[model samples]
Target chain A: MAERALEIRSESHTYPIYIAAGLRHQTADILKGLGKSTFSAVLIVTDETVGPLYAEEVAASFADEQPLYICTLAAGEQSKSMETYYELMTFALNCHLDRNSVIVALGGGVVGDAAGFAAATYMRGIDYVQMPTTLLAHDSSVGGKTGINHPLGKNLIGAFHPPAAVIYDTETLYTLPEKEWRSGLAEVIKHGWIQDPELLKVIKDQWLDLSAVPVDVLNDTIRQSIQVKAEIVQLDEREAGIRAFLNFGHTLGHAIEAEAGYGTLTHGEAVAIGMDFAMKLSGKVLGSSLDSEAYNEEMIRLGYDLTIPASCEPETLLAHMKRDKKAAEQKVRFVLLQEAGVPLVRPVEDDTILDLLKEEMTI
Target chain B: MAERALEIRSESHTYPIYIAAGLRHQTADILKGLGKSTFSAVLIVTDETVGPLYAEEVAASFADEQPLYICTLAAGEQSKSMETYYELMTFALNCHLDRNSVIVALGGGVVGDAAGFAAATYMRGIDYVQMPTTLLAHDSSVGGKTGINHPLGKNLIGAFHPPAAVIYDTETLYTLPEKEWRSGLAEVIKHGWIQDPELLKVIKDQWLDLSAVPVDVLNDTIRQSIQVKAEIVQLDEREAGIRAFLNFGHTLGHAIEAEAGYGTLTHGEAVAIGMDFAMKLSGKVLGSSLDSEAYNEEMIRLGYDLTIPASCEPETLLAHMKRDKKAAEQKVRFVLLQEAGVPLVRPVEDDTILDLLKEEMTI
Candidate 1:
């Protein structure tokens, strides 16, 4: 397969993202080409599930170079916590990894976030590379937003430490479970909805059964999604402006994930539902002319439950949204679509949100 | 006393350093003048000792505009640990501090480093102001280096998050204990040794008893020391080149501090001994023509112990030095001075270091 490369340019740093199948073996050569020869050691941070499968292969690539240490955490959102981050730092210290060392994050978003945060802070910032094994990481891996979750919220503590490179090997996705595919596809769907409506049309026209999608189609979709994300991030690395559009569905998405308890639902599952709610709210509040019926049918066909759980109270979710990092002066800020490919971030009133939640519950 | 301001320009950021005797009352105005009107809340991170003494006054400055919360840690080097850092993050979360919130580090280096690190990681970086309460902070408060210490070494986990402004009120130093004065003077002397010999000569000529030094002289000396540090940091924000010069005495100094245990001996005291050892080593190894006898007499006059403590073993200190973040490939790197203003950073072999330890033990 031919390799495709994209450059993400930000004010502080610019790095490339290489997408291809079966490129894991090129990790060391690619890193050396990027001017990383002075590192004394490499710490590979992965999850237990991914560790036993691919870590050795990646480590083998660096066999002749500096010593490589693998630090594995349990696989899931629960692993993205302060406790896990602290343990990873301690592991790096025990390995005697210095400022000259490099950290290789070798799993999905959980491992990437935890490890990237550890690298971001270990010795006051070091270099890290992202070798994302999951399709969802196609979005998370590019931007420099590395962090661990607080009990009160998701990604409340983090840093903008961009990865040295993102080496995405689609071959690894062959082993992904069907449910994981549905979860990852939600983000791809989100990328299409926010910036590239044509991509959404293509996804709808092709790949009706995500579980059995063609490899070429998957590769093209993932690449397109990353390009949208990279363009937004490059323009606003700190999220001071246009980057807020990327959170079109994440405000309520994160709340649902937090209220549902982390890992109870995959990130995509929550985001899918959040997107449904946001579309309805935008229609009522902003008079957005989105084709809600068509969007809902597509989401249901893609294996999503668009209903808010019975256990989750409207008031509780509203409180969570207001506490979101985007909130200002106790007002719940939201990214509402004026139309497809045109998102607007503004503060929504509590009474209006309550009304929307009541309406969502009836559905 | 008149106010003095200096601008530190780096590739990543530009901030001001305001030095005066009574600027504490103007904290809020200074921040507003710097265009910080959007903050939803202000978090004051201080130590227990300084919290009781000055936190209320500082808190009162921000009373009308935004909500204020104070999180205080114990006053010492031991507080610069992961446990404290985690607690600060949790506190910020509980207070609902978001991306727009500002963190005011209202104490010396310990509070500044710990709080600055928290702000750096909280929401992937936020704005923070430095309010230096100790003269020793003249060095730490200027640089963008912020972090917590690991059990393995000091500042092993951190980031280079620069402050938005540094408000130094010399009035705070008047209440400092005599021991704290001696502790802060070591860094002042170090600044003189590394870049400004004229400053060193002035210190030696004017101040015999550090405890009784005139307030005007104290303020002038601190301003001069900060200028030296600011000039160097402006040239190298990430510690890539000229920044290593600032670590002239820190390699061995940090090892001694680690071996002695944090807070057992003051930081300046450790640096003083480290400076003495580096000078002697430079004379023997680099063939430098430094007058060691005259320097030692000056240090003794300033109430510093020029000899390595009998309790600290040479092999142990060497082991600690090898673990420093600056160490590469098990060889300890030291910042040695060929003369008063010419510094060199290079690796010293294990055998040579052991032999130097033996020589120093005999003294």
Candidate 2:
């Protein structure tokens, strides 16, 4: 097991991200080492699937240092919801968690989001640590962007509360299915395409097959992906400017994910398609010489369905894109990967967007 | 009309607090003058009572500056419920408000709290202007403590999101009832008792009569009261240290307010009682000659009901006091104004608190 550490700085504070295999067993010492040992109580928020697998081991890591409480939610993207968020608040209050308490987000992206949001709003914000159990969580576990989805839009309700720390235990990733591996890889690849083109080469050369990535490679991949996000977050903690670049494929990816109805497609799968579309649009609109066909083939080789679901219409996606929280004056802006490696965010005409969508539906 | 401005600086940004007559009518130009001219949309969150009285006037203040929307909740402390907060989020979404939009928290503390909370968490927070319609809101509008009450606690779910600015329209105070004046005056007096004794002299000399406060006197009083809070908040934006001093009476006052059930007694009325009790405790526990009887005499003269109503059990209040969110390891600490003007925060034993409660109940 290789141990790697990265530091992220937000406006309020600086926290460390610890990526290692078997860190779960050493959670107590790590938290103490980071000087975050005083927790009045601990609330471990894990999804139902991960609760049975890893929640107890994580709870034992506390070893009665503070009273521990567990809140398990229904698994997947659907758990990132208002009802669940509200219920988590009640549960925290009922468990006698107070200002000094720390919330342990002990599962995947959905758990991190739902639990991170709970930590964000409970008692007007409390400290929380990300104990990410899945690969998809590597992106969410950093950057302090915590939120739940609104019925009308994804992440319309949320906060930019950075976690006290991130303790990423890679051992849990072994239990993840092949689909989950593919799902998590999109954001990992996104980090490559937007920030560091070098990150893509690591995946391209050694880990094209998602499930068979080596341990040292996985640790490096997680650190590099997180470093890209952390640097963006460090520069713009509140998404004031550079952080929007992190939303490279998210402009279309979010609309596609939301229009397809949450859980219909894993976020990475939707983003993989979004990334493909962006390259194609960039070549067509920005006159970038990026090979969109080659990009599509690469995505296909990595096992992504680039085809837009017939049930999710282009018009509906356009509407959702316009409704993205970043939109001001109903302007539809996208993070276009214009030259394969370079991404730019600019407003594209609705007609141009609609035409692109219409063309995608035919395929 | 005379206008005064006070600047408040939080960790994120510095926002101005404008105290004036008819500022609501001049909102458009004022926002433009302050360099906050672009609002994609404006959502005015008022209560049912204040909505009919002043929401329309405030909305008209925008005057084609941006798309305008209003969300009116049931009036009073009951309106600060999780259900109402959730509904407000849905309404903001349905209104197509994006992150660029601003929320106008119009009306009393209830509205400021619920609406400011919505502003704080809506799309991970947006800018909000505090349009206070009640004297009680003078305290709430300044500090940027925004939240909805959990069934178990007051302001348990909230954020420390300061408003973009506070637009305090004094003209709205003209329509307030005597109970409202007395209610708001308690906080005014609290500022004097804890921070600056000069504040008490202003109220003690000219405005002892709750209903007949002259306009200039009222303006001066609001400024002084807000200054006390603004200074405290400026020093400790996140309630880290000196800010807790602002909760001088709130330790027991909040317990009493919650135990009595919200809206049972006006917040100021409850705090009035808590202040009296705090002085009493300060005298008994800290051996300070702060003159509790004179404080009681002054409060009674100001038209406050100092009686504990015989129904709110002292034991219940003790339990609620222990559950105060600031409690760590169940140790109850309170900001005690031991020497009338100087306040101190230190842990008080449960026995001492229970004994004090029992003594108060007998009276």
Candidate 3:
């Protein structure tokens, strides 16, 4: 029964993360294990892309068990809007889903986020299971953070609502493009940078290859990444203290996403660049002796474009950083890493940040 | 400082409920007491009705302590909507109100609910203070329940987020119409029915008069009502168990509102009628020997119109009841009162409920 799975025991909630191949077909059996949730209905919140591929298979898994509804959203970051969230709620309510209804977030980070947020707020939160189909979701699927993007800021409107369980099927990863896989790998790199050195070795073994990963290797890699995420989350579920370390690269990454415009760079690509800048910043501020060239080389080899577009003004990026959702008191705070597993969230002056941005981002 | 105030010690959170007159002018002083919230920015979310009367006073209370912004939504239930929620998030984000910002929900239940919901989600939940102006807010102000209505359901989307504090200024209630006072009273009676009998006696003394109550009596009554609410909320912050009792009348009341059309009857009046049906059901189902005449007399003398309108179909109301957000497994369960301080939630057979609905609702 213990088929490559680990349980995340957060401060407030404890749930399992199943890392295996073709586990999506076992949705019903897995949910029956949730002692408290006697859900009589299931709403599979999926996107046009993931829905077409796996929604039917997952829905068929619930045959005669209970009523199951599938809601297909437009695929992309745009679907994580209030309009989409409202539509999903209307659709759920229209289908007569009651309190015992469970939402199945079936897709990557975008689908997980939007669907998870819907679950967070629907009837003041209903039980939801994360059926993440991408590697980026390995990061988001563990943490209870769920939300949609506001036009002014991404994730400005959200909640810290955890899923009941995460059922990840590595088989689904086979269909993803190499760039998508590379984009997801950046977060795995982040998990390694923040917590596990063994994960770094795993990535190093693959070198620059993103074409394909053997099933067993992929499952193990996902299990390791989720373990790092689960440990951090268990320590600080609400981002009160150590959880801020999870944002190691997000501070500058979010600003770049804003300055360069979202959809211009995959989230992992920007975060990879952000981690590089944070690394250098750590060396300057915390006096950490780390090999900058090797770190840069590893990211580049992993197919991440760390080049900051010239159009992204240092001042604008700095402004975006200050306005970051994680920035308390409008201070530009970055999660600076001294080394693997040791991180600090501290405010850096605008001049210091601008100096680094100009030096690194302007080619 | 033994003022007329009580603290709510909920399972997840403990916050103060200050019940007094002229507390609006004391916003800055009250907020300084929160230990961990080093908020440098304040967003006072009020409505047109209340903002025009007190926004400037509350904003000035900040007094160079920090930056404060006021966003006034349109006054009414319609304001408790996704559009308004989105607009408020946009406004707050545009003003650069980051994670350290505090939101002041300053108005009646609508304003408190909408503003509190924004606080619950903005930057994935920030600190919020409830400055309830209406008597009805005494019920909503305590329970950490924050939400906006969807097109399909009332409060279809929300969160169980507690406030930093609830500052109830009864001086503001003086401006409220008598109808609003009576409307708020319905919840006071609900609290009394489920928890405290003393609160019921307090209301009995002021029978048939919506005009005015002395400041001392008003303050004490609100304190008692809030005390009952606090105790119940402390037991179950989320409606996992005992918190369901708080929905004694709300189960059918919500359906009546939906079927009879919202805004036709105040929330309190609909609830009062729902309580009557629940009381009668409790007698028949639980064999509780309660005087129906005395209960009916109290509501009538309290100036509540208990008529359930001829247009409401029993089957339609039954359907709505089954679809209630609180309903489990699509079963129409109700918080039926055996007597004061003894409430039991049980699912009534559709025929049983239909018979009662036909007998009582069909005038």
Candidate 4:
């Protein structure tokens, strides 16, 4: 019951983002506070791995609740597909969930995206809570970019559907492999780099070994990252203007992900490469000292694989980027870094993009 | 183009409602304003009946600007199904429509509901316009209650997605069969009965002989009905409160439609019977002088079969109504009329409903 809750206030709703070590142990008290006097049915959407660990604990929390349906899918980005989305919707309908029913999403980014999209479309939207068990989910669950991937591109069909609440239990991260932890940290690093230079400095100074990082520090970092995302989402719920800034590392990142095929590489790894390219382009265009060669060295030292794979050529990535929904006409837009706390979206010329790719390949 | 334009102003949007004798002549100009310069694809959704006449017209309107994709479904309530919705989504995707792509609903209420729901979900929603060709669409086009039907009930799966604009070309009514005209007028009659007693009197007087009623008067009546619907929808976007008033005849009417099989009888015809039964119950419970007997006589004179079909037994109709989305706690709630101008949702006891049905059958 280590409890210092992070509060999120949106235009339409206000809820707490509870981040604690082993918060799953207090599920009953949290459900009571959320005003579940009589739970008729609950749907738990999870992945192949996390379901075994926490599904029973959550179901036990609501033992008196009749007919709790637990549905699990295969882990990874490939699961975020139209087929899975359709299956989940049919499951919800078969479960006879009224509007009062709550769907709990428990896994990493893929599970959150697929499950949340299901909740958004099933019966024209319903209440959903994010029980994020992976570090990547700490970002995806909070901001509510929920949707499945289209065959043409990653996240081509989706909606901005905020969850009813987010429960990030830090204890679940203890079982995560080192590579998974690194994969998650890229996003945390991006958040810090984009919004808070102070947080970035703190991570740079304190984070050396992934295993030994204090739970409180990790919780604070996740909460701060979520707060930054939540504030941006509140200002623009539907990504009309400033909200597009959240695509800081996503333009080239998505193309790389789509080219490599989903599940070939973790999302954060692709994003790590995209962020490096964007920073290089940002330095070229904006001449920011923040994007200097030292910044690249720092990123490499922080255990980020910042190279675009030889299998996915820069031209292929460019072709995929053109197919993205954000592209206006034939020109693709990238959200590049102006400085540590400032980002800008601009259309880069094809030759310049090619030159950057060529130069970065030698490194 | 015989110009008649009025603006509909709501909190989220302000658009014009246009009515003209031959407004289809202005389709090109109307679409030019609505079509995005970025999207090169246009999807026109129409019914089998209307497709032959107007699909080419709409296609020609957008000929210079974008590629037109015409999709026609069976011209009835049966078209409002998950299969139809999925097909429409696939059509849009296959057409290579991005976010900027536009959908034009070109038939009646069925087309509007089906197309609007497709737009609401396709690519997580896209822009759409309502080019309503029938009088009943005055209600459906303005309210944004777009949905596909579930096996359990009508509008069981839906989203409240407002269209970009509504273009009502009154001249299309010249091609409508007298039966089709009568079918649409049922909704017009319901709108008048729920909110405007004066409009009801005008219809009753002018519509004594359906052949004698001028098209201008009919158009005005439908437009007024649309205003009433739009005003209520503005107050309650979703059917959370005031909007439920619009479902006055829908509960029992839906049951009758479903029981009879969707294509067997027109929507308005089913609603006309529902109205007769509702008015009779209202007179009994609310002590209103509705003249339910006279109402039945007038409907019969107007060539509407106001009596419930013998095959539609009371218990079966009761079962359908109980399964209706509007029903709560296993009670079939009826929106009863205290007077022509006032409607209230009341829970009618099972015995009371059975008595009213028996009495109405005798009458």
Highest DockQ among the candidates is held by which one? 1
Q: Which segments of candidate 2 are over 4 A away from where they belong? A: A1-4, A258-264, A308-320, A323-331, A338-340, A350-363, B1-4, B255-264, B312-320, B323-332, B349-363
lDDT of 2 by residue, A1-363 (tens): 223489888888889889988888877677777675577888989988999998888888777767888899998778888788888888998888878888999999889988998998888889999999888889888988899987676788998899998999898899999888988899998989888889878887878567878888999999999988887888888877978888888878888887787679888999988887787778677888876676677778888889987788888888888755443456687888766467788878888888888988886
Candidate 3 regions with alpha-carbon error over 4 angstroms: A2-4, A206-208, A310-332, A349-363, B1-4, B206-208, B307-332, B349-363
Which whole-number lDDT from 0 to 100 does residue B206 have in model 1? 82
Candidate 2: tens digits of C-alpha lDDT, residues B1-363: 224478888888898888887888876666666675487898989988889988788778676757899888998778888788889989998888877888888898889988999998888989888989889889989877999887776788999899888888888898899888888999999999988899888888988567777777887889889999988988888777988888877877777777777668878888888888788778777888887777888888888888876768877887777755454456678778768679998777788888888887786
lDDT of 3 by residue, B1-363 (tens): 325389887546778888888888888888886666568688999988999999899888777867788899999999988888888998998878877889999999999899989999988888899999999999998889999887766787888889999998889998998888888999999888888987888889864366488888899899998888888888878778998998989888888988898888888888998988898889878888777788788888878877777878889988888764443455678898787788989978888888988888655
Candidate 2 chain A lowest-lDDT run of ten: A322-331
lDDT tens digits by residue: candidate 4, A1-363: 435467666544666688988777776556556654544568999988999998888777765646788999988767887677767777877788876677888888888888888777666667788888988788888766788776655566665566777888888998898778877877887777678777777677877777568998888888888878878877876676878887878888877877887667778888888888888888887786674566567677777777787788877777777764443455677888788878878888877787888888776
Q: DockQ numbers for every candidate?
A: 0.80, 0.78, 0.72, 0.38
Clash list (residue pairs), candidate 1: A124-B158, A124-B159, A158-B124
Question: Which window of 10 residues has the lowest lDDT sum in candidate 3 chain B?
Answer: B322-331
Fnat of each candidate: 0.96, 0.85, 0.89, 0.24
lDDT tens per residue, model 3, A1-363: 425389888646788888888888888788887776568689999998999999999887776767789999999999999889888998888877776789999999999999999899988888899999988888888888899987765677899888898999889988998888878888888888888878888888853367577887788888888888888888887777888888888888878877787778888888988888999999888988777789888877777778887778888887777654443455577888778767888877778888988888656
lDDT of 4 by residue, B30-111 (tens): 7566534645567889999999997887676554656678898998888998778767777778788877788889988889
Q: Rank the candidates by lDDT, best first.
A: 1, 3, 2, 4
Candidates' interface RMSDs, in order? 1.0, 0.8, 1.2, 3.0
Question: Of the pair 2 and 4, which is ahead by TM-score?
Answer: 2
TM-score of the second chain for every model: 0.93, 0.92, 0.94, 0.90
Chain A TM-score by candidate, in order: 0.94, 0.93, 0.94, 0.92
Question: By the DockQ metric, which is better: model 1 or model 3?
Answer: 1
